[model samples]
Target: MEWAALLLLALALCALLYLLGRWLLGLDGDLTLLWAEWRGKRPENELPDKVVWVTGASSGIGEELAYQLAKIGALVVLSARRENELERVKQKCLEISNLSSKDILVLPLDLTDRSSHEAATKTVLQHFGRIDVLVNNGGRSQRSLFVDTKVEVYAAIMELNYLGTVSLTKHVLNHMVQREKGKIVTMSSVMGIMGAPLATGYCASKHALQGFFNSLRPELGEYPEIIITTICPGPVQSKIIHNVFTEDLSKSLDNTGDQSHKMPTDRCVRLTLVSMVNDLKEAWISDHPYLAVCYLWQYAPTWAWWLMNKMGKIRIQNFKSGVDADISYSQKKKA
Candidate 1:
């Protein structure tokens, strides 16, 4: 009986110490990231003059990444559904850097069209001879309960977010494998790491990405030169919220959250570039408290779930209120 009691006491003490270390000493978040940074080596191949293909390059982080890569002298290929916006971004890239029209190829692509990925890859290869880095940043977001969300909504998001990314990666993978050197950078999200409210389909799609890339990472052991970086960034100021697909398969333009807290797109892309340059396997880029949530999900899952549940309820309430307001306004306008 005394031995059992002692074992229980020991376990309790260990748990206490771990919590204290994680919360008070800052052991679980940036410190862990710092250790990773210290241990990581910079990629042997520099970014300059490298052929870097960025998808969803029309706006937000993708557009910012294109400009930054251009500044670094990379031959940037911009792809997205918006040809006009892509041309604008291309012009911006050219203005910011010494790159000319020939250096920055604007290849407008619809990620949902999986059949076109091979042709897109061929076009990129034909233009640049080879793609040194492929950034898979094209995806859609969702904001609705699973029960309320249409079945087709789930399929659409999964097709765009998961299958589309996978198809593009496959098209690029063959080229990377043949050359035995390349980098695949994927834009995941905090929702990818853990569950969140009103993002059931979105979370599932991001989780699928995590599983797919992580499984693929180990299989490429023979090719150490090839690197795969998955970036899970917390809310950054972007059109993602405005573009979020709702239960009825309509886009939400409510602007429902406090933009003050969101990180700037440029800042997010800068941190992501640092991770890419360092060849970090995975990175969660965000402000302090938000970035700390990833660690909470990792080290203290039960607590994380409780916190998320509370937050989820609040978000759902806000969403419903916003929807009600919109309906009332529309009715008044009709009257």
Candidate 2:
């Protein structure tokens, strides 16, 4: 009887210590080691002629990425819905590179259309011969509540975010696998790590992407030089805030939110570029509230992430801002 009582007391003490340890980690859980390890493993840069495709390049982070890659001498193909915007970006990149305008190709593509991916790839192949890196950074975002959202809204989000990426990836995977060399860098939001209350469809789509890529990451290792990288960052300073879909199931067409508090698009693009060059599997850009929520919900238990994500009212109100205000698609948020 005495032994049993002692064992129970010891178990309670151990449980208490375990909870205390977890609380301590929660208080100071920094990923400096992970960052250092990733920094140490960056691969050498590819040559100038390596064909790299940047989708959603009409504006935002995609344009930034295209510009950065051009500076590094990589042949770039920029795609988006707006050819005019794409042309502006291409011209800027050429000026930056001191290279001929022939080096950059502008292909406008609607990501929601799965059939469009093959045609776009064919154009890239015709112009550049073959692509060495494909950056899938095109997609729409949402700011609707799960309870208030229509069923079709979910489907549309999936079609654009998840299926759209998969379709494009499928189109390129065969060629990349055959050549045994390619880089597939996906732009998924930090919301991919944890769903927020009012951003149901966006979160779901991003989460699905994380699952798909994580499962496929190891499978791609069979190809000697193929690299698959997924990037997740907090709210980036961009037109995405103005692009929030409304509670009435309507997408906003004007900018009406606080864009000042968001992270700079250039910084996000540079980080993404460095991650890709380094062959990182995953990256999370640091920021305020959202960054904290990313961890509190991801490593936390089931209900923990849920409760933490719900601690906000900004999601619904952002819906009033016009999604159309994005002027160009957001490659960072689209990631």
Candidate 3:
């Protein structure tokens, strides 16, 4: 009887541990961000009636973000280089949400145009009276070997992804500092956390963002309510591949491989809102393998390097063969 009771207890413990491990593996985001999604302040509760300025609002994650924010009752300012696309996103937002035409502002912006950022900030503030949140989502990615790519391509990537973001943030941060309260959420990537092949420039840009925001957070110690949040999302289904800078600035990616396997855009934006509301200093939003690698990168970097070496080879081969670097490896596993 004693032996049977002990055996049952051991089995129960093992079962519990197995389930816990499974749950962790299934998670699409870091523990902190997911915890905020599950139990922390909800976006609906926190974001309603707030003014949110989202850059890169013409497509991809930015477009999806506009739709979600509309549903949540947040007043949104949509900006990108293309006015026509911004209008289309605004119209969709109007159709889906209760917000009227005046509630959604379509301001055309070119992030690379640093001269216009100050005036852009004023325009948002003039219409809204105050800027409550700034979503620095404007940026491009790269897909080329460092040796093959021109120095100009690297300069352009930094100009748009790093310097452009910083320029906009500078203008907005001045306002946030004056108000002494708001959220500045920048859409970084898992690429920011780890280095990989075919994206040397992209990784460097994101690293710059990570270092910038991480350092900026400390500088704003005087204003506790002014939250600086960095969102590092892994591959979510988007048109990012179509826009990636290749070996030369004049060229574009010919094959944007299967994005079907990536995490859904809506899911990523939803968690981003959660991180914003909860005031998380930094959040990692991504699905497995990448998410797991983020942990290895942070805690056990030597092991992370070993794993990346194995994975990087596969990524380079996929790029060379004109297949989606991310999908080919996973699809092979599924096969």
Q: Find the candidate with the highest TM-score and give its number.
A: 3
- Which ten residues in a row are the worst by lDDT in model 2? 323-332
| Residues 101-176, model 1: lDDT tens digits | 9999999899899899999999999999999999999998887877877898989899999999999999999999
> Which scores higher on lDDT, 2 or 3?
3
Error of 3 at 271 (Å): 0.4
- Per-candidate Cα lDDT values, in order, are 0.82, 0.74, 0.92
The digit string of per-residue lDDT tens for model 2 on 98-215 reads 5678888988888888888898888888998898999989877776567766887888788888998999999888889888989999999888987666677888899999999999
What C-alpha RMSD separates each model from the true structure?
Answer: 7.8, 7.8, 1.8
> lDDT tens string, model 3, 1-335?
99999999999999999999889888888988888788999888889999999999999999999999999999999999999999999999999999999999999999999999999999999999999999999989889999999999989999999999999999999999998998899999999999999999999999999999999999999999999999999888888779999999999999887778888899999999999999999999988788989999999999999989988998898888987888754522344
TM-score of each: 0.84, 0.79, 0.96
Residue 95, candidate 3: C-alpha displacement in angstroms = 0.3
Tell how far residue 328 is off in model 1, in angstroms. Answer: 24
